[model samples]
Each structure stands twice: as structure tokens, then as C-alpha cells.
Target chain A: MTVAIDRATGKRRGDRTPRPGLGRRLKNGYQRHWYAYAMIAPVVIVLGVLVLYPLAYGFYLTLTDADSLNSARTIGVNEIEATYKFVGLDNYADILWGETAYDRFWSHFLWTVVWTAACVTLHYCIGLGLALLLNQKLRGRTFYRLILVLPWAVPTFVTVFGWRFMLADSGIINSALEALHLPAPQWLEDTFWQRFAAIMVNTWCGVPFMMVSLLGGLQSIDSSLYEAAEMDGASAWQRFRHVTLPGLRAVSSTVVLLGVIWTFNQFAIIFLLFGNTAPDAQILVTWAYQLGFGQQPREFAQSAAYGILLLAVLIVFTSFYRRWLNRDEQQLAI
Target chain B: MTTTTVTPAAGPAAPDAAPTATGPRRRRGRGAALASHGVLTVASLIALFPIAWLVFLSLGPDKDDYLHPGRIWSKMTFENYSFVLSETNFWHWLQSSLVVSLGTTVIGVMVAATTGYAVSRMRFPGYRKLMWVLLLTQMFPIAVLIVPMYQILSELRLIDSYLGLVLVYCSTAVPYCAWLLKGYFDTIPFEIDEAGRVDGLSPFGTFFRLILPLARPGLAVAAFYSFITAFGEVAFASTFLLSDTKYTFAVGLQSFVSEHDAQRNLMAATAVLIAIPVSAFFYLVQRNLVTGLTAGGTKG
Candidate 1:
């Protein structure tokens, strides 16, 4: 540490003044920022121990061929050291392109994309619609909002179970369908139904938040803009497109980013609703989870690789999205 | 200036209406109001159906009565609720869940406030980097962290323990809370901090005695968020809490579903029991939640 500090000291800029002593410089920085450092110490420590360290450890685990069976264990001090061998890049390779595993990986990735896209789009549209409706001088607006936001207020696992109940083969939804003389398909059994059920429940669970968020966005828009648009003889659609959309730009971007990330990694709905069901219905996050913990002979290395890949995909997507948002700056030579 | 800077976008959030509560908005035709109401009512029905169905199912006498809806209508009873209360480990799960959730909320909020205030008020050498890290951490989610989390938890002999779960929940909640509270703290005036310093108060005194009390709304939002997040978490709870005795509601509820038998009635009862308190808790804090959320969200 002292050597590193000494190295830092060797570089002097063109300010032809006497440089402070190394100890004084060190003391200065500490005196200047100690409060800030002290304040953040708990956060830094907690995040380090729980997240960063594990992330580093998870990367290392991915380099080895570890599984529940072969990995180290301690049964009351009868310590069994890990027998798993270092097989660098093998787990990643197997997960990405090994024939049987590749099929699973690619299919799950595709579904995850579809699921995330479908759910976020639906949530945003429906939420925006609901927000727009409630933003008016309509009767019982509060009443309607309170009821609509119920799903979000309830715990996710509970609501997932609620959907599971209603979507079951002989559950009320099917029973209602049959009574109305509509054909009742096997919701719990069929692959299409499984995927549909997952998306439907997630959308139902998600839309309330989007609605509330967008509603907040709607409220925040200056009413004077609407009046100005009206004075200019802009139609409702025209006013919405020009005024409302721009006004909502900030809230919309953040929520959409959040929505994408949340929907992409949605686990409890998939896991609790369909416990180790059809592989075709599984998304990548849940698939990785099932690999690591849900199934017997838990594939720790493979699962960690899947997780790293998922993180990589999200980072790539976010960076691209950021670039797209900043494209106007480039175009205008800002 | 801070208020306008936030554009602090929270009001009685409209479901599908404008906040143009005066002037020409009230002059909309009766037909338009009816149409808006019609759409909202239908949407509300769709939103409420599954939950309402769960509550109804919970009252049925037999577990299989859901499959035969006609039987449930004929003989509705609270037997399932009784069974879930008396015959199972429901109380234990509920207690453990509350312990972990409360612990996470207390620790997460306390830890985050300092970080939040630091980032909001200070420009230390690594401040920008810390903010960036907090932002990036959201994308590196539960899936990526689960395996290593398991390994670390076990090493500390923390698996199946409430403290273990609380610590794990903190990793997910604290960073986000820090990010959020920074936005909130930004809304508070710098004059107050200066005033605090004038009174010969240390930075900590100024923060805890002055800024914190004033930042109640933000702290409430942060606390509520932390509580809900830790309460509803499943992947970690199911994996780390190895024994049934340590199971949270999430872990315990799943056992009923995967049992290869009909326990939907009891599951429904438990679901209803859990949802009431949580939903009520949500109701208490939702206004602040929305306000704090949009304050940060609008800045994005």
C-alpha cells in the first residue's frame, strides 16, 4: 500500500508549488472523506460479504466441475473435502453447445426472451391504459385503483398460488369455461397452457405497479400543456403523443428498464406455479435454478455458468438500450 | 427548487384518468365517463378474480371441493382455515418469516440511510464509482448470486437460519434502498445541513437528529420496500432454509402444492391469512412508496 502511494506521488503536474508530504497528503484525503467513508462502511461491508464475494466465488465455482455429490461437505466436523476437479471453460462450453444441453439452453433462452418481452409490454400497455383512465374526474377512481392494485400488495408467492388455484385443470376458471359451453383445455398439463399461464399470472401480478407508476407519471405532467394543446385544436391522441408522452419520458424509461430486468428473472411464478414441469415452459433463470437446487445431483458449476451468461446478456441488452437512448446526442453532435 | 427538480410526480395516481381535476376536464361528456368506468370495472374484475377465488376456495370444507365447485357452493365452511391453523407448521413459518422480514427491514434501512446520505451529500474520491456500482448491481440478480450465496451461507453455518436469510435479503434490498434514499436525500435542502453544522452538531448528529426525521417519508418507503422484498423472497428461502421447521411461508406453501395430493384448500387458507396483513401493510405505506418511487424514477 505504501509503495502504491509512493508511486502515485511520483507524478507531479505543472503547478510549480511544493507538494505536500506523503503522510500529509494521506491525512488530508482521510480527513476530508472519513465521514463519508464511515457512513458507507456498513453498506460496503454487507454488500461485499453477501454479494461481491459470492459473485467472485461463483465465478471460481464455474471453473470447476462441482456438484452436490462431489463437492466439499461437513457433517458435524467430519469434513469431506471437495473432490471436484478444475475443468476450465468445460461447464460454459457444455451449457452453450453440448448437443443435449444446447437444446435446453437455447429453447429456454428463447422462451425467457418471449416471456420477458410479452409480460413487460403487456404490463406497460395495460398499466398505461389503467393509469390514463384513473387520471380523470371519473366517479370512484380511488375505489377502482385500490382494487386494481391488490395483486401487487399481496405477496408474490401467495398470488402465484392464487393463480395456480384458478388455472388448475378442474379449477374455477376451467369449470367456468365448461359451464359456459366453451372447451376447457388442460391448463396445468399442456405446454402452451403452461407458458400462457405463466405469462398471464405475471402480467396480472405486474400491471398494477405499472399502472400506479404511469398514473404517477400522468399526474406529474403539467395540466397547462393539455390546455395549450386544446387551444391549438390538438385532438386527444395528438395531445397525448406530443405532450403526455414527452412528459412521461423520464418515468417510462426507468420503469421499462426495471420491468425488463424483473420480468426476465421472474422465478417464484415459474417455480411455484409449475414445479419441475415441462422444460419447454422454463425460462433461463428458473432453468438455472432447477439445475442448481431443484433437481437431484444439483449441477452447481453448470448453474453458475448459466447465471453468469444471464448476467452477461442483461448487461449487453442494457448497454445497447443506453446507446439507443443516447443516439440523439450523437446525431446532434452533442 | 428540489420539488420542481424531482418534478416530484406522485398524486392520487389515476388508474386511467388525467389529474386535470379542474376546468375543461369536468366538461367531458357523460358517455366518456361511462366508457372509462366500464373499462376500469372490467380491468378491476380481472385483477381481483384470482384473489377473490382464493379466498372463496379457502372456505370450502374439502380440499377437492375446488375441482367440484358445485360441492363448495353447497357446503361452505372455515374448516380449511381451522386445519391450517391447528394441524400444521403454519405458525412457525409465519413467525420465522416475520422475524427475517423485520430484521431485513431494520438493518437494510439503517445501513442504506448512511450510504444514501453519503452519496447525496458528499463528493468523495470513489463516490461516482459507488453510485455506478449500485446501479449495476440491480442487473446482477438473484439467479447469478444464488449458488455462491448458498456456499457462503453454509460456510458461516447460517443456512436454515433467520439471520442468514436476513443477510441475504440485505444484499438485494440495501443497494437499491441506498440508491433510492440518495434521491430522497437530494430533495432535502442543503441549508438544513449547514444549519446543523452551525449548531456545533457533528455530521452524524445532523444526519440522525435533523435530516433523518425530515426524511421520514423516504425512510418509510425504504422500510416498507425492504419488508415486502424480504417477506416475499422465495428462491433463497426455499434453498437455504433446509429444514421444514425453518421454512418461511413461501417454502412451506410450495410443499403443499408439490405433495402429489389435494391440499389446495389449506394452501388457500394460508394464502388468505398471509395476504391480509401484508396488503394492509402495503396500504399504509403505498402513498409514500409511490411518491418516493416517482421522485427517483422521474430523475432517471
Candidate 2:
């Protein structure tokens, strides 16, 4: 084989080889890895043009008085020759501190946080509960698992639309409540009910992901630990708290972090459910979409500012999450 | 390894060796099993009820049945499905969705496979940083890119075009697909590459001819994921494709409700139609989907 011949001659050649110049060695390394560069070139180029350039242009647009009507014309023309006036953080200032608009920003921010927190908390609880239940040996567990996971398999647009129909004032849920002589809250009209419905629908859509993730984590817990805990006269709650909780910590944290990001930025459920017209239930994402696309004289720059702010917040959270994950991996390794 | 032992031990029918176990313990086990089954049944019902109701509404005779939940099955018919299929532009939207989704899948998988191979197997400067950049792309909100993506697409005269939509979808899908493929490629041994090199194959040739076949499962996972993503995406597709006939099923379905009021039956039928293919695809690849998703989350 050529490989055997090369190996045989390579060692002999290495023994008498003279050191190469820096340029020669660098060239050799480049030659050896040229294919790697070629392989990744397309991805780098496409992402650069599509993702990175737009990202930079978006940041630029944030600094200008761009709108839906003007953004295309402004950015379409040469960047340097664009007619849109640069506002230099005025959009940010207006959204953050301009008295009337400030309330909108803060309220949306608060709802975004609340929405993300409630959804992630409910998702984790419901999902972990389901995982725990399903972990027990039971008849038709596989079928139950499959059925429970169907929500996730269904497209989110469909699920949200379905939930919207179900939660309508005259829909099945209210009808069922009325049948039982219970008060039926107006789900879409009232702010509190609207937010509740949004979170409930999101949890319905999200819990399967959590359940499957936690199920995997639960399955990975060694059974011997449970046996040992039982031998020590640990109660069921104690075993769960001491053993199961600890075992699931890493996976739970990851799931929660991801859940926070997704829920914070979730647009479809709220958008399709309320048609992006429910002001009382607006989170940051839909609010941004409304600013940019929902109304005439759309505030593209302001919405871009909102997006940048959301990105900044997420970056901070993600860095902390990455740190926690790294620490968890280290602890596991040790 | 532990699953084999743990399953039977926790099962209702304990082994004969446990005959000395107390009767109360056995009864308690049975009760616990019954309780679990009860909970599972309720949870499954809750999870599936909305979809079942949607299907029922889709099959119901008219919009009036939607208001009266009790009458869901009173007058069932297949007219709604027929109406959506024949009266609406549903088939047109379906074609657009399929073409865009398949195009994205093909391109997304090809680029991801090659890029993943490079990142996984080759020793190159900036490869680690490239991987991090790819991961970061996954974290960035799609909303942030909406304005710029719109501008870029418009500039390229691709705003209403399938090619433009496919490109945007590929941009979103490629990062995750590449990461998934790279994780898969890492599992493959390097000795195969060395052996291919010994056989006088170039790096690209080895990757294409030798490594790609071995990574079919990973490629399948990536392709399915990309297809589902492109198929179900509404935010970008809705924005970029402004024409009604050009709309993907997601946008088209959304328009059915937004544009036309009191079309719940037809809307539900359309939703069911949109969901069927995705669900079937999911069924075929559910196992790989779980592994791919968890792997991306935990590892990437």
C-alpha cells in the first residue's frame, strides 16, 4: 500500500530532515488544510452576507430614523448615500424614557419577564412531573409518552390557533365551565385573562420538550442511589429531593435557560392567538413586531432598538448559563 | 445498562424471588401503579384533547357547531376538507411549502455536511471560533433579523421568490444542522480518513465518498429538522412572501383566519392538513429527533 511505503520512508526522512523556514512551514500547513478552508468557505460566505451583514446593517438602522416605508429605500440605496437621518440613540432614549412611550417599554419588558418566567416555571413543573410519572413502570407507558409528546410534534402555529379557538369566550372551555355553573372569564378581552391564556397555551406547547428532556435526565440517574437512599430509611420526598433533584440539576438548568430565551422571544403563539392586535397582552417580541410591521408609519429604528435591548439581556443571561453549564460539566468530570 | 434492571424491579409483577416481600408492599405497588395509570390517562387526554377537538370541529357540519361544544359530533361531514381543498388556494400553498422546504433541506444538508466535516476532522485555524459563532447564531432571536433580512431580500429582488425564502431558511437551519452533523462526525473515527488518505483519496473525496455514507443518519436528522423548520416557519415567510399565491402554508393558514372571520371549520381542516405530513415525518424520525435535539442542547 502507498500508506505503508509512505510510513516507511517518512520516518527515515524525518531523522535527517533539516528545519524549514517559517514561511515554508506556514505554506505547508496551509496546503495541508486548504480543503478545510474550501469546505467552510461557502458557509462562512453565506452567513456573512446574510447574517452578519444584516446584523450590522440592523445596528446601523437602529441609529437612524428608519421606518417600514423608508427602510427599504434607505438601505437599498447605497449605505453612505442613504437619506435616512441618523438619530444616534434618540430612538433608544424615546423608548426608554420618553414619558408616554416609556410606560409601553417598561410594561412590555415586565410582561416579557413575567411571561418567560411563568411559562418556563410551569413547563418545568409539568414536564418534570410527567417525566417522574412516566419513569415509573406502568402499562402502556410508551403509548402515553407518545400521546403526550404529540403537542410538540404538531406545528406551533396550529397549536396556538387551536388553543385560541378553544379559549374563545364561546369556545369549548367556557362552554364546559358554564355547564358546570362556573364563572367563565373572558379570555381574549381582559388583560389578565389574555396573559393567562397566552402562558397556558405556551406551556401546552413547551412542556413536551421539557418532559422529554427531563425524562432523559431521569433515566440517566443510577438506580443504585435510590436503593441506597431507601436503605437509609429515606422518605419518598426525601429521595426525590436529595437524589432525583440533584441528578436532574444540570439538565433542568439547561432546559430552563433555553425555555427562558424561547419564551421571551416567542412571537407566534401570541401573534396568531390575538392577531397581534391585543395591546393588553403584548410582550416585547410582539410589541416589536407591532412597532415595525403592525401599524402604518412603522417604527423600524425603534423596533430595532427593542431587538437590540432584548439581545443584550439574552447575552447576559446566556453568559451566566454558559458558566453554570461549564461548572456543571467540570463537577461531573471530577 | 441500568434500564434493564430498573424496569423489571419497578414493574407491577415482581419476580418470584421476592415472595418474602410483604403483602402490603405488593398492594401498595399495585395502588401506585393504578394511580400512575390514572395520572397518565388524564395527562394524555389533556394533551390530546385540543387536537381531537380541532379534528372534530373540522369534520363538523357548520360553524354553528363550533359555538356549541356539545354538538361537536351532532352533524359530521367531510365538506370542510373538500371546501379547503377545492375553494381555497390550499393546494397552491402546499406546493410552495413543499418546494421551499425541500430546497432548504437539500441545500442546508449539503452545506452542513461539508462544513461539519471540515470542522470535525480538519485542523484549521479559527475552526473552534467558527463553531462558537455557529452556536451564537442559534441563540440570536429571529425577530432581531427581521428588518435586515427584509431589506437584504428586497435588495436582491428576492422578496416574493422561493429562492429568497429558501436562502433565509437555509441561513437559519444551517447553523444547527452543521452543529448536529459535526457532533455526529466527531463520533466517527479518524482512522477511516487515514485509510482513505492511504488509498490516495483527497480530503473532499474522502469526505464525500467515504465519510458521507457513514453519516446518513445524521444527515437524515439534519434534513428532517430543516424541512420541518422551513415548513412551519411563519414569521419570515409571512414577511418576505407578500403575494397570497406565493405564501407558504403557515402564512396561508394564518391568513384564513385573519382575513376571513367565522371560518373555523375550514381553518381547522387546513391546520390538520398542514400538520399531517409533519407529524408523519416526525413519527418516522422521532428517535433521531430526540437524540439530535438533546445532543444540541447539552453538548452545543
Candidate 3:
């Protein structure tokens, strides 16, 4: 009713107004754009509250001793006198050096890098291979493609735990190995094998994305180029190298960047398989979870320190990607 | 939009590069091609082995029979399925998941649609900056946000609630949705809205009554993505929603296999049940997904 009222008032004024000058046109533009502004307001507000605030809060929380159980307290002036009162660099140092903190922080950090690298590389190799194979003309390609994508389509917890179960002592893998007169690797009991299992699970979850992306890229490639390469006396390898690979450059780069970020931050495969109980396999994210949720004497400051460190690494990666993208564009322009 | 044309290799000018056209030679080529395809087909099966193993385990003769599928079989049974269905709280948890996923999709689409429309069609100050900031948000690791988000949600008394999970899910989904939707909306002609305006409809009516109908495919894709994402996301659900009754199907299903006791067959059955609906959902929306993802690149 109020909206109608304002409309009627504006309509009455519309009949009596002399045509607006340049200044008034500018003003009218602002007035007309208001609805658009109003529509976008909620999105901006929600992002600010949920994303921006937490990011800022994460940075601030690093300087405080606000443990989950502690209820956000000050560490006092005497503690400050001892250089331990909400000190900024101390938490960073604690995470950097195993000195004032929880155990195996560095080990987890190293594992995180290795885990991400393995996941990304395996996903790329298998995914690109699948993309190339499926791109070829084949009978029952649709069915085969659908079956391959099943691992990715299923939810994470189900498949991650499913793999975990398969790796169990009396599980299918062990059973199959025993039947074949081969020794079953103690998949969960060992550190390196467990990490391999984690990577396998992560790769299982991740490859479909890369495959789909590469498929899209391959389909977009101009087939005439392949024919042209063949006419130039190029073998299959040369044609694929010169045509298909170059054709896929942009999509492939984007795939690698996205895969890196996703695998780097992947938590479920490791957390569900190993949890905090595995002293060796914990990543930064799982380590943070342990500090906050896994233990009683939770160290919020140290967790925040780890969180901040992870953010810095990711930010650096993002900027590097942006620069890489710009360079690619420039080269293409040339 | 640069269309660089490469000259064809096997065209009339380069006829010498062709393989021998003799029948026997062609037969051998076909045989080799078939062999290569056979190898790849086997490889594909091996790649899909885990899923096959899952299906077999679910339908195994008994819980122990799964450990020895090649050996003397006990018998096939629907007992695992019945055990997962009738004896467990899985159905209830599945219902919770459906509600939370559907709710997040609805809210996310609504918000992203309106925002995307505005950014695409309207002249607004700082709009570009806002878009960039939203993209920048994607750079932050979800792991980095975990602790602070937990604290904030805890403060709001939203922990262990559908509302918290939905909010978090929608927040993460909006940036990509909005980006994609904005790109989609830009491809729409502005003349349609102008025509609606001249016909005496309000700007709101122009969008709701005219533009939205045209953007239906885009909206469907966005909604489908949001739903699948909310449906699959387990980290936030497991972390935030602690109560057993409130737990989503994914998390609840995880509880089937604990530290000491694990019903591998029963868990497989439950997992199969979970996969059915999600797979069905994917199948239903499969066509739209390919179109949606490619739309961002092929269109302006």
C-alpha cells in the first residue's frame, strides 16, 4: 500500500514537471538505480557478515587466548610482563617452531604439501587420460563415462569411509590379496600407506572434476587441426602434443589451479580416515580441528596461528595464479 | 572469440599422407583400434572397481561373505538393505539432509538471482569492486575459516541447527552462483526490459515477469548446483550439527562404522541407498550441468 502511495505521488509530479536538465538527469539516474542497489544489498550484507567478518576475526583471534572453553579472556598484565600476554608473534613462532605448542605441527604441514601435490597430479593424469579416451569415438562411451564418474558423484563420507573399510584387515582388498597369494599391506596401521590411502581417496573424489573440464576442453578443440597435423606427416603423439595439448591450455590451467586449492584444503578424506589419533598424517586443517574440537585443553591462539598461516599461503597462490593468468592472456594477445 | 583456422592435413592437396586404402590394411587398422579400445575398456572397469566393490559388498551373501566373495558363498539376501532401512535412523537423517539442501538451494538461488540480475543489467557504483571482492573470497581456504566460523555460529546460538548449516552452505555457494548467473544474465538483451518498461510495468515487474522467464535455464543451473553442493557437503554438517537426530544422512551414515565395531555390509547397503538418490538427482540435472558450465566460457 505504501509503495502504491509513493507511485501515485510520483505519477502526479510526473505530469507537472518541466523536462529535467543534465544535473536532474544524473539525479534521476541515481533514483532509478536505487532498486538495483536495494536488490544487491542482502548479498553484500550476508557476505560481509559471514565471510569478511570471520576473516577479520580470524586475524584478531590469533592475538587472544580465546579457547573454545575459555570464554574469551585476557591473559593479564603480569603475563604481558613475561612477554606472553596476547603477544602477536609468539603464536606464529609456536606454530613455526614446535616450542610453545601442540606436537607434530611441522609434520602435518609437510604432509599437507605432499598430500596436495599427489592428489592434484594423480587427478590430472587420470583425468586427462579419461578425457582423451572418452573423446575418441567408442561404443557404449556414455555408459563407460557414467560408471567412471560414479566415484565422484557419491558423497564424500560414504566413499571415504568405504575406501577405509576396504583397506581394513579383513576387508575386500586384504581378502583379494590373500586369495592371490600376495601380502596385504597394513593400510591403516602404517603412516605412509595411510597417507597413500588418503591420496587415493582424494584422487577418487577429485578426478571427475578434472575429467569433466578436460572433456569440455577437448570437445571445444577444432578437429581440423588434428587432421592438418596428420597431413604434415605428424604421428599421433605429435598431433596430440601440438594440437590437443595447446587447445586445452586454458581449461587445463584453470583445472590445475582449482584442483590445487581444493586438494590443499581437503579435510574429509584425512579426517575420517585418520582423525587426530594419527599423530603422523594430520594436516593443518585437521590439526586445527584437533586443537579446537578434538581435545579438552584447546589452544585457540595456536589454532588461529595455523589458520592464518594457511590463509597466507593460499593468498600467495591466488595472486600467483592471477599473475599467471595475465601473462597467458598477454602471450595469447601477441 | 578469435577463430584461428588451421589448414586440413588430409585434404586434396596433401593426399600422400593418407593410410593405404586397401581392404586388408583397413581390417588390420580396425583390429588394432578395437584392441586399443579393449585395453581402455578394461582400464575404465578397473577405475570403476571401487564402486563395483561397493555394490557387491552391499548385496553380499552375509556380512562375512563380503570378505570372501570368491569363496563358498553363504547366499544373497536383502537383509543388509532391510537392516539399514528398517533398523536404523537413516531415513530420518536423509529427510533432514533433503530439507537442509533444498532450503539452502532455494535461498541461495533467490539471493544470487536478484544480485546477479542487478549486477548484469543495472548501473550501480562499486559494482565491479563488489564482484571482485566476492571472487577474492573464494581464495580463502574453508579450513582457515573453520575456527572463526565455529565461534561466530556458536555465538549466534546457531550451532547444531539446520539454520547454521544452511547459512554456511549458501554463503560459499553464492559467489560462484552469482558469477555464473551474472554472466548468464548479461547475455540477455536489455531491449526486453526496456519493452516491459514502456508497457507501463514497474522495474520490479519487468524483472519478475519478463527477464526471469527468459533466464529460466540459468536459474535452473544455479539452483541445481546449489542443491548438489549442499547435498554433498559433509564437513560443515558434521562439525556444526552435533545432535544425532539433527545429523544429516552423510554424517549419520558415518556412525555405522565406528572405532571398534563396523558392519561393512550394512554400511555398504546404507551407502548404496544414499548414492541412489544423489545419482538420480545428478541424472535428472545432467544435461543442464554441461550446458551451464560451458555457458560461462562460450557466451560473453
Candidate 4:
């Protein structure tokens, strides 16, 4: 590519003689795109080193017994021939059906799906409502926007810890409920309430982004559409169903997809809230963390295998979404 | 500016017809609408209650004896803030956080802006392929990279250093920042760059003088986001920066939970202190943050 580019530059400069041939033409073509290539070099080099190499290295380490004890044992006979050494596909199989692995593959998969869906759905509902309310020419709009954005603005850990404290046995929410003569539900103790609190906190942090995004989307929908629907004597529900929903479809879909990916990979809330207390609170990523870093001789390959599985699932969903969007685009073009 | 009279597009000449739904009873519909909005506002306040509680708790007295369980007035004091600011390594950690987050923002935006411009406006081989690769990279859990990163940073003798944290944070930020900036760049016409190239300036000069200036708002948005991400990042910093002096404010606040003394008030005060800087920065750059966040979601 380099030689071709140089030759093309030479031809473009008219410094070369006739009969420069196909090679020269190819080089000239490359030269035309040289600056474009130059512009992209930093991206390739930076991403290649930091992202691609590490990702590949992560997979490589998965094939070897690169546990904590094998730090310096990169290449050796006994370690290689050991029963635990260099067993290709065994780690993956172990994660899939290993007795010791707390996460049954299918259950973790189901939990991930359920968790993602519940969080995103609740966030969207609350977010869309706020966007609708704020989109109005109302009083104290900026103040409300600032207030609503706080949950997302604060650091993830601080918000998680705050929720943990509030949900404690004798914390603020319980205290407030007691003062109000209302029953304080066991938020962090019961299995159902633990999940509920996690979802509530996660929704608090997640909803603001969607609200802001939908607010921007709402601004773009030509008010004339709504006005036209009104002139036709269409009800508010009918107008929203036809005009607002279609207008919000694109942004809402993007929000849902990104929300799923982020929520699935969330570690801070569940980790800090449960903190090794409830074994079932260990999601896929947190489980990976405990197995990889919580032990004396860490199982790096098993952790990597788990991460790889998560990545595979995400890729499948993303591609499925992309295909779905592409079909929509094609239909629109038609 | 004086108000100009423009004709209504298609609604009722007066706005009253739309607000009043097609009910025989106008009072009931209006009342229901008001009630629903009131309910929504109340629900939103409930959602926002934790931060409100955090603020009040920070201002509350130290969690010591004379623990009056019921009276809220008795808990109001400023001692926790004074103690948190004076006793702990809060100042040093705050300074470290500023350095690390600013470094990540500056480097991340500088790299992403140029590369995003190239990707969005310039055409070359493997351009589409590069975007696909970058997008796919986002799915992988970055925690998986921490151990290898630890090994590499350790070998480089950069353990517990701001330089090490900055580099890792900036690297993780590059993909998303670049992708968003590319979306922004796509909005700017290629003719701007073409005009620059036709004027005989080098591509780099054109980018700096022409494109970068025009993309300032977008760049501001990207930088704010990158800054916030780095500022709030805890996982890698906690794992990598082992020394106490090297801790960012995020982990420093966790120190209040010692084995012996659990100063809930002081910790809340510290959390409030850290949150103020973050929230202030967000408020300052909110316009850009909103734009950067909603980058690819909406068309117009």
C-alpha cells in the first residue's frame, strides 16, 4: 500500500514518464487517498494497541493456564502437561456446565435478559413522562431539568452507596415511613425487595439520559403534525399514538439498545449493595470479578470465558437490532 | 428583541381548543390533566429524594452520641464537613481526580476530534470496516482488560501514577468519544474541508483552522462527556492505584468506612463534596453534554 501510494503521488506530480503502466496507476490511486489514510492512522494505532491487542491477548490467556500462580510460568513442561494446563475449550465448557460455577448458563442468561428489560422499560416510562412534562412551556423548567439530571450527574458509586444506606434496616426511607405511620417494606433483606431496590436505583441513574434524548427528539417533531391532528378533531391519545410515537421510535430504540448493554454490564450497584453477603446477587460480570480477582490463585481463563460469553450475546443482540433497523430503512426508502 | 407576529400554522386560532379535550365537561378534563401532572411532579421528587437526603445529611451533625432518633432539628450541624475536609486526604484525592480527569479529557478529545473528522468526511479503504470494528469493541467488558493492563503498567513502572491512570482512562474513552464526534462531523459538510484543500493548506492546518473551529460546540460536548466518565470512573482506579496517596477522590471517600469507626455523616459530607464538583462541572457544560449524549439518536 505504501509503495503504491508513493508511485501514485509521483504520477500525480507529473514527475514520471509515459508507460508508467498498471502499477503506476494503482500507486496513483493510492496517492489520492493518502491524506485520508493519514487522518485514520491515529485511530488504527491507538485502538489497535489498547483495544484489539488486549482483546486478542485476553483470548490467548484463556487457552493457557495463565492463573495468578502461573505469572512467570509462561512456558514450561510440567505446567503444560499438568491436568489443569492448556486445556482448550475446557474452560468454556466448565462455565457452561461446571458444578462449582454458581451461575447456571441458562439462568444467568435469563436474569441478564430480565434485568435489562425491566430496567430499560421502567426508565423509558419515567423518562418519557418527564420529557413530555418538561417539553411544555411550564414554570421552573430549568430547575426541574437540573433536579432530574442529578441522579445521572452524580458518580455511580455515590448514588449506589446512597441507595444502600437508604435501604438499610434503620435508614432514611424506613425512618421516613415510620414517621408517616406507613409500613416500611424490607427493601434490602427479602429476595424480591433486593431486586426491586436494585431496579429502582438503576432506573434512577438510567432514566435521565433517555429523558434528555427524548426531549431532543420531541423538539424535532413538527408541532404542525399535532396541530393538524387536533384540527381533524383527533383525540390527544390518537395524536400521541400516531404522531408522537412514530417520531420517538428511532431515538427510543437507540436508547433501549444502549441501555441494555450498559445495564447488563453494571457492576457497582449490585456489588456494593450486596458486598459478598448474598451469593445470588453475583451477576455475570461481578461473578467474573470475584472468581478472577477475589482468590489467591485467580482463574483468569474462566473469567475471560465468561466475558467472552457476554460479548457474544451482546453482539448477537446488536446485529439483530441492526438488521431490524436496516429493514425499516429499506422499507422507508421503498 | 421585540416579538414578531407570525401566523398560526394549523392549530385553533386560540390555543384553548386543544387543551380542552372533546368532553362535554371541560372542568373534569382540565382537572384530570392537572392532577396527572401533579402526580408526576410528586413522583419525580420522590425519585430525586436520595440526593436531597444526601445534601441534608451532609449538613447534619456528626453521627456521635446524643443520637436523638426522632427530632430532625437536633441533627443539623456543620461539623462533619469540617472534619472531613481537615482530617482526611480529601484535598489530595480531589486534586488527583482533577488531574486524571482533565488529562483524559484533553487527550481523548484531541485524538478523537482529528480521527472522527477523518472518518466522517474523508473516504479511504477500510473506512466502513474501521467503524464496525470500533462499534464491536464497545461490547467487551473492559474489566477483563484490567489484569493485563495491570501487568503492562507494572512492567512500565507506572503503577500508582497519574500517568498510568490517565492513559488507561483516555484509551477506554477514545472509542465512544470518537464515534460520537464522527456523528457530529458528519453534520458538517465536506465542502468546508474541500474548500480548505483547494486553498492549498495542508490537511492538518485545514483541520485546525477551519474544521476544528466550526466543530467547537461538538468538541465541547465530547470533552465534557469524556471528563465526566473519567471523573466518575472508580473500578480501574481502585484496582490499579494501590497506594493511599495515589487514590482518586472516588475511592478516597470509601475510606470513611474503616473497621472501627463508621462515620456516616462524614462520609455523606465527603460524598456531597465530591458530588458538588462533578455536578458543578455538569451544570457548566450541560448544553454540550446533552448534545453529545443525544448525538446519533435523533436526525434533526
> Going through the candidates in order, what is chain B's TM-score?
0.89, 0.88, 0.83, 0.85
RMSD of candidate 1 to the truth, in angstroms, is: 7.4
State each model's CA lDDT, in order. 0.81, 0.79, 0.71, 0.70
Q: Write the per-residue lDDT of candidate 2 for residues B10-73, one digit (tens) a residue.
A: 5432221111245555656676677778888999999999998888788876765678766766
> Candidate order by lDDT, highest to lowest?
1, 2, 3, 4
Cα lDDT tens digits, model 4, B1-300, are 211112112222122223434444354445444644675578669667888777776766756321333454675778878887898778888889889999999888887777887766554678668777767765666556765666567557677899989988866788777877876776676667667867987778888899889988888888888888888776677777877766887777666665327777787888888888787777787767776666633321
A1-334 in candidate 3: lDDT tens per residue? 0000112223433543224323434766766668888878878887887788887887777877666555542254322221224666766766777563445576777788888888889999888877776776557778778777776677777777678668877887888899899988888888888787788778878887788778888888877776676556665555566777878876776667767877877777887887665767777787777776678866666676777888778767766776766567568669
- If both were scored by TM-score, which would come out higher, candidate 2 or candidate 4? 2
For DockQ, candidate 2 versus 4, the one ahead is 2
| Candidate 3 lDDT by residue in tens digits, B1-300 | 211112222121111112345565355446545654775687567667777677777887455655576652456677889887888887789888988999998888887788888866665677657766765665566666777888788767798899888888877888767766876776676678778977988778888999899999899888888888788776678788888888897688777667216766788888888888888778777656755754443331
Weakest 10 consecutive residues of candidate 3 chain A by summed lDDT: A1-10
- Model 1, A72-177: lDDT tens digits are 7798869888899999999888888887865779889988999999999999999988888888876798999999999999999999988877888878888889
DockQ of all predictions against the true structure, Cα-based: 0.40, 0.40, 0.31, 0.29
Per-residue lDDT over A1-334 for candidate 2, one digit per residue giving the tens place of the 0 to 100 score: 0001112223433443223324334656676577789999888987897788888988988999988666545345555433578889898888888978756799888888889889999999889888888887667989999999999899998887788778988999998999899999999988899999999999999999899988888888888887776567555555677788888875776578778888887888888888765897988888887887788987888878888888888877777766766566568669
On TM-score, the stronger of 1 and 2 is 1
Lowest lDDT 10-residue stretch of candidate 3 chain B: B8-17
Q: What does the lDDT read for residue A68 in candidate 2?
A: 60
* Model 4: lDDT of residue B130: 76
Candidate 2 interface RMSD (Å): 9.3
> What is residue A215's positional error in candidate 4, in angstroms?
0.7
